[model samples]
Target: MKLLLLRNFVFTILQSGTVVGLIPFLIVEPKLNDMLTQQLKISHYLGMLIFTLGFFMMLICIRSFAIDGKGTLSPADPTKRLVIKGLYKFSRNPMYIGVLTILMGETIFFKSYQLLIYLLLIFIAFNIFIILVEEPRLRRDFGKEYLDYCKKVERWG
Candidate 1:
């Protein structure tokens, strides 16, 4: 119970902090690419839309894996059950992919290199969290089931 609490606390703080940090950076820098260029571009909006779609896909994956039980927090428990449908079929870490997509979308929308830097930091932090905390918990909880899943799905896909 205590370990679950600690895991939730740490992940929440890290996720919230990265998102909060991104907001101000996005706001201050408006559509820079538009201002710099005389003509508008279709590709920019298309890219943003694609990222938004990916973000929602990640949300769906998270929802599908959610445990109604109190003991589980991180969706790292393979014993909790396997989620192979929807976005889970495509990527093991849809939530992280969604997070990355949001960051990428922000970078595209705001046209800010600063937000890109923040996105890189977010990636690094998430990578550490997955490696140190999430993976070990999954291995402990799910054992062979998770190992098999790992073999099938790429970590960051």
Candidate 2:
């Protein structure tokens, strides 16, 4: 419905902003001149490609959440159904992987140890949140169906 889509849009924006938008870049400013002394480098373009893939992966997951699961990324408005399609078929937390991938790309591009540390912190936080919150809620909401999916899929594949 229109209402669900609207809510999804709003929450997606909020989460995306915090996870992959200006916040991280604000924290980790890359020096262009120092990024690579030599002219164009493969790692430079590779970083962009990785970033694009990460963003594309996120879009796919968000679409799956909305169309297939009737949900947003926010815990307050989680998926009504378990999403086990596309990337979900491989990993239970592909959205988080997408986020980490984006961060990884930024770190590689910037060559910033601060960003790398930030990525590690984010990963730890995500893992804790998933273990303490998301997984429990999924078990409560979807019960055996979710457990069965967990059996079939790798947690972080």
TM-score of each: 0.67, 0.90
Task: Show how many residue pairs clash in every candidate, following the order shown.
Answer: 0, 0
Q: What is the C-alpha RMSD of each candidate to the true structure, in Å?
A: 5.9, 2.2
TM-score of 2: 0.90
Q: How accurate is candidate 2 locally (lDDT)?
A: 0.86
What lDDT tens digits, residue by residue, belong to model 1 across residues 1-157? Answer: 5665555455544554347344635553475455547454674686578667766765465456553223322544322665555676677777677777767876776566777787798789889988998889777877897788898888876
Number of the top lDDT candidate:
2
Mark the 10 consecutive residues where model 2 has the least summed lDDT.
Answer: 29-38
lDDT of 1 at 114: 76
The alpha-carbon lDDT assigned to residue 109 of candidate 2 equals 73
The window of 10 residues in a row where model 1 has the poorest summed lDDT is: 67-76
